[model samples]
Target: MPRKSLPALSRRMFLVASGIAAGALALPHSVLATEPEHTAISTLAFDGESLLAGGANLVRSDDGGQSWTELPAPGPILALATHPERPGLVLAGLASGGVALSEDGGRTWESRSDGLPEGEVDAVAVASRQPDMIYAAVQGDGLWKSENAGQSWSFAMDRPWLEETEHDLLTLASVDLATGMGGIWIYAGTEAGLTRVPDCFCRWQDVQPGNAMDALVSGDAPPSEAPLPAGEAVRALASAPSAPETLYSALPSGIWTSRDGGVVWSHLVDRPASAVAVHPSDAMQVVAVLDGTLQMSRDGGATWTALAAE
Candidate 1:
């Protein structure tokens, strides 16, 4: 579902169902008092102490989801990823042809797009085992890599399949890091299909076709009113820190999980979510940010509770 077409539910209803209202109400007035009335909570990433969200602007919550403080960045953030080893290091992909890195949590940011082709940075992720290395999916430009943090970057792969389709790399995720290779496994979701890129090679192999890619490739025309196909545009990808092989993809229709990399997947959740994040410390505790609010699943996406709304 496009962020704009989400159903309008009352803030009270949204908060009550998500079980975040009670926690948010307990937060100090200073932190919860200055929310931007018009902001939409688009993407979410956690740094242990605070939940960082990127949307129309950036916002952070020290007290769970009860209260929030705006942390404006230079541009609209399309994707957000936290370094697995570095507690505060964060990479933000911008809607424009740019990328930003934050060393002090998200309090500050700096642009780092050297050598990257001109295009929107659709996705961003850091090596869970190697925090210094980062990867990005540049729309129309293919994949890029930054070996030394975000100071500099180089094209990692630009396969003919990616270039010929003229599709943007909308989502990217690192599958496993236990192997010696810094980025052993990668998944790239494009308008054409999901591309599975292993560490040994630079070319991407297209996975099975589904509505998720079709919707985005066909311009948001969901196959069904039931949120299945719409949830597969590869809006978000997350790998459980505790179970590296367990990967989750946030598609337009719903959430899908794969226990053995991207070879097979099963539906995890049916809600239309824009982004999903796993608790770095607990895989069972995950959060999904939708167009108007947030959802939490304690049992690994078996069920969901709404948190808040615009």
Candidate 2:
């Protein structure tokens, strides 16, 4: 299957991002397509017991990635996040604007963008420890949070302002690892780099060390810096709920995994990946979107098998 360009909203955001880092925005031609005949997948999530894939279409697989069944989706899905414990609770960030809540797995959906801004929702993540707590990264607007599932939302944080540009956030995730502060960490992948803030709503810090301003925030040391070269951004992020310390991030460089709660990272996959997901209960079973196709690795990333689309 040949990949195509993403929808209009994502393209527009990429154009804006190109102003700061033009090379990083040179997306391959096989990412997404709007035509129904051409299937396009950009994001993946584990719905506790099953795996959900979305972009131009939505599909669910109960038996890992061996088989799939198409599911209902409001529109082109930009991102997806499912509750770690709630079997059927899912959140989908739409390319159109706002988000949709699906409680009956992906079979049904309801609009849940009450307080969100009118722009594409780039990414969304639901807290594992607190299923009701959620985070969304809106395109033009910054990040938004919801305490009561997706009933409503409020501003949580602003996008990173670097090099005179407010970098657009491309992905978001809420990791359960304790931050020594009052809460876990909420991370966002932007055009600039990977940045995170303790749920305490304190200050945001880059995952890469050596920031003079970060020194004045607290004595707490920064998490292990990701090995991405300067100007590379994390394009997608996923962390295991059963093992909060385990994290997988997809970037233009490739896929990287962290076992010590983002303290130490090791490159796992060498090719660029658009999205990644770990089984909610089993961290070793992983799936990633490579060149707009689905690939699964049962023993972490030691090996991989491409899954045929149904």
Candidate 3:
């Protein structure tokens, strides 16, 4: 029998995840289109030229959005990532099923949540340059690391510095890997702000408006929608491989950018962004989701162009 189908494992998972409710939580409030609710798109990832989307289920398009096929998964997928250079390596974060890894692209999968505290995976990320390293953001849980690919996880937030953090209440909305001139860094979207972690994953910080606020105060771009609040929850985030220092962070106030890594942040636009994805090869190109609409930006998210559903 397949290891994933083991009777004990299945029974435990069913009890732990609470079945359908957990799977539904993996998705953002999806747009209720005339189309079937199961087909409503949520988030997106790119594997080569193929586009993969998830909401209530998993779907893929090899030739852009001209055609899409529903893909089988252990449960409803919440977030996904594809290896940049690897032709057949995919990782998925499930709503209530934890994380799964695939060596034959999306054709097959194996469970990889041995040490995860919670099976509700909110986001997943993998750097193509080093495929063996992967990260998973568990909802309400701080984060988990898997050094040996996605075989297992070492729960974070055990550090003393994170003791003050309410990882149980703070929902990790999104996570992305940044690599380039500055260095390799990990970005996570949270209710407070966009959080960043170093290569060692020993410590972390968030995007603060200290020095960057000076530029905004002087009217570099424009006055923000309102005064920055005491706490800002990040809706989504994306980082380009070509520009590691650059981070696009979506906050309730608007979208902001960090040029010198995530140290300083400046408001770029005052538009709501629910989700974001950077181009695999081009840092200047980015895709964002706004009110369930697809928008693309070729100028490093400085501007955007809306894309109608196909």
Candidate 4:
């Protein structure tokens, strides 16, 4: 079905608070006639021109943020990863115990959860170099892998990280394989911190404190509508395809960028961003979602301009 843009907020109030001209802002096109009650956007991925966003709802957009289309999937989407080589191939990790694959640009979807444990799927990663390789992090199951392009699955990690602590895994990102990173390096974001698992899936290491990992372990009753805690609680993470050494992490304070391959980091943005994605064609072009608002940056995080939502 066609997507619906968010409800129009008070433009006069927004402009007075943000000090921007309301007339200059472009309104979002109503992709759907009616908006759903809950829309928890957990992850976002781009396929050159179009964007695939997963959360409580599965959605796609071809004209940046101007218009969106809702894509029906098997279950509530928690994570999404687009195929590196195949433009239309996309995979979605659901809150239920399975993953969904779409070969025809999300017009239709099929479930692939033969080996996945019956639990919420927290994270997913597609190997940029090895397009056929897929990885998923199950809430109670450490990690699962699909080598046949989501056709079949196997346990990638011997032990599940979710079992080690009460916290749950939230996000996953793969480093560019061409950088000699060896295999598709996967980074798992959790309440404890950031966990690094080599593509080989031999061992997992804690790369949170010393490394550029910043995270927060929320209590059972996390705030229903509040941003994560500052200084900790990694809201999101994205790796640059052009520069493997540089990765960006979203924290409560703002966004941080690391140039030394997750070793050293520097602050990039001050506003809290819940999700971020870099354009595949232009590494410097970035789009971030903050508190239901979308912002864009073309100068590699140097400056940001807010995109209006209608």
Best by lDDT: 2
Q: Please report, in order, the local distance difference test score of every candidate based on alpha carbons.
A: 0.64, 0.72, 0.56, 0.62
**lDDT of model number 2:** 0.72
- The stretch of ten residues in a row with the least summed lDDT in candidate 1 is 15-24
Stretches of model 3 off by over 4 angstroms after superposition: 1-40, 127-129, 159-165, 168-183, 207-230, 264-269
lDDT accuracy of residue 41 in candidate 4: 58
- Every model's TM-score: 0.76, 0.82, 0.69, 0.75
lDDT rank, highest first?
2, 1, 4, 3
- Sort all candidates by TM-score, best to worst: 2, 1, 4, 3
lDDT of 4 at 62: 78
Put down candidate 3 lDDT per residue, 182-214, tens digits, no spaces. 235555665654455545554555443333333
What shift in Å separates residue 199 of candidate 3 from its native position after superposition?
2.8
Compose the digit string of candidate 4's lDDT tens values, residues 104-209. Answer: 7666666777777887776777776777788887886677888887778888774424434545556777786332236356866665555566675655654433
Evaluate model 1: give its lDDT: 0.64
Query: What is the TM-score of candidate 4?
Result: 0.75
- In candidate 4, the residue pairs with backbone N, CA or C atoms under 3 Å apart (3 or more residues apart, or in different chains) clash, namely 3-31, 3-32, 4-32, 142-160, 215-233, 215-234, 216-233
On residues 1-310, what C-alpha lDDT tens digit does candidate 2 reach at each position? Answer: 5543333233233222111121111212222322222125668888877878777666677776555566656667889998767888888888778788778787777778888888988899887678788888888888889998767888988887865688878988887764424447787788777777777666677553443134526555554455445578888988888797788888877888888766567888888787899888889888887655578888888888876552
Best by TM-score: 2
